[model samples]
Target: HACVIQLPFNQKVRNNPDFFLRVIAENASCCYSMLKAKNPGFTLGNRGASGMFPSEAAEWLCYHAFTVKLSNHKVVYKCLLKPLKFCHWGCFKTGALAVLCHMVTVLANL
Candidate 1:
């Protein structure tokens, strides 16, 4: 009995973390197209200029935690979904992200 099924995006993004991020990017009202491509950097706000490819983004999110990189390679959908904010973009009015980023920054300085 499998507890969860994991499927990844290739050519199209749908019904996953990438889908949610896409919807938020191409929201009918806004249509800012925030996610340009899946690269290796932040994919939101002005910093998203160097957007991440979906695959890379998922890997980065899953591996990069508390500024430490994990050795796991095979990532499941649920893992990526847990950390993403479905409708939220960047740190805009998002105190939690701001705090988290601040914490990481402070820790890096130590």
Candidate 2:
């Protein structure tokens, strides 16, 4: 509960234990990585590159916790949703991604 999630920007910037904003990256490392690709250094004022991606991350956290897929669980939702003024994005962005679609359709069709 006291751990941090480092965002792509934060990861590239070297190290800052505040990127816990990863709850927003939504396990989408690609997007997360791309979002911080432009700014390859530490964040300035708010430990973020005054841009859309960082804001997106913040916005995501306001309604979610951990970089897991969206769910109907209240506890999970609220946890992921709890907004942190700032956090690390690199942590949650590290794991592998699961296929989000239902494979049953393809299998049944086959």
Candidate 3:
């Protein structure tokens, strides 16, 4: 239950006794998606470190991408992690469709 703090859970997961597990799975999937997007060459699926913290990875990846200083022949790490806002701007209409597609696929298999 230490993982998967946030996700778009179904009403079943949100209202039922299996809420925690559902959350964990959603959080795991989010982590998996982000890692896959960032490091496409890495083969990560149902396998990962025994325990992976999304917040920790989120902080690390955010810093690595947004912070750190790069200059000619020089790279420096300030090692400061900032509190981040969970905001995603721009239209995500297509993303919603992708989610719908995946949901349909899952339901079809079931």
Candidate 4:
């Protein structure tokens, strides 16, 4: 199901980068927390440390192309797309279809 939705979500982000950035910025706390938890070091601040700040993370997610591995390890960090898609799917399933539809309509109008 996630794989099915990923393509459209990726295209949406590509088509509306600014809109997706705003959406991500609105949920900055969630992004920050998740990133901090995943990378407990200076990874959030130092771009040289295979690290990415929140905005870069957002941009990477928008393009569906971020592949920063942990320092000296093979573990690839999690992408924001997974959680975002989970939340979206959950909302759509839990009586938020109208709201989502309205969002789609708004996006379409843009």
Which candidate has the highest lDDT of all?
A: 4
What's model 2's overall lDDT? Answer: 0.35
Off by over 4 Å in 1: 6-92
Relative to the true structure, how large is the alpha-carbon lDDT of every model?
A: 0.35, 0.35, 0.34, 0.43
The order of the candidates by lDDT, greatest first, is 4, 2, 1, 3
For candidate 1, write residues 1-110 as lDDT tens digits. Answer: 02123333442222345654444333422323334434335544333223222323322333233112211322433333434433233332333345445546887999
RMSD of each: 13.7, 14.3, 18.6, 17.7
TM-score of 3: 0.25
Error of 4 at 11 (Å): 23
Q: TM-score each candidate.
A: 0.24, 0.21, 0.25, 0.24
Comparing 2 with 3 on lDDT, the higher-scoring candidate is 2
Residue range 5-28, candidate 4, lDDT tens digits = 365534533354455445554554
Model 1 lDDT at residue 17: 50
Best by TM-score: 3
lDDT of 3 by residue, 1-110 (tens): 11223434533222442443343335535765777688766543332221222233333333233323211112221111121112111112224324434546887999
* Deviation of model 4 at 101, angstroms: 34
What shift in Å separates residue 7 of candidate 1 from its native position after superposition? 14
Candidate 4, residue 97: Cα displacement in angstroms equals: 33
**14 Cα displacement, candidate 2 (Å):** 32
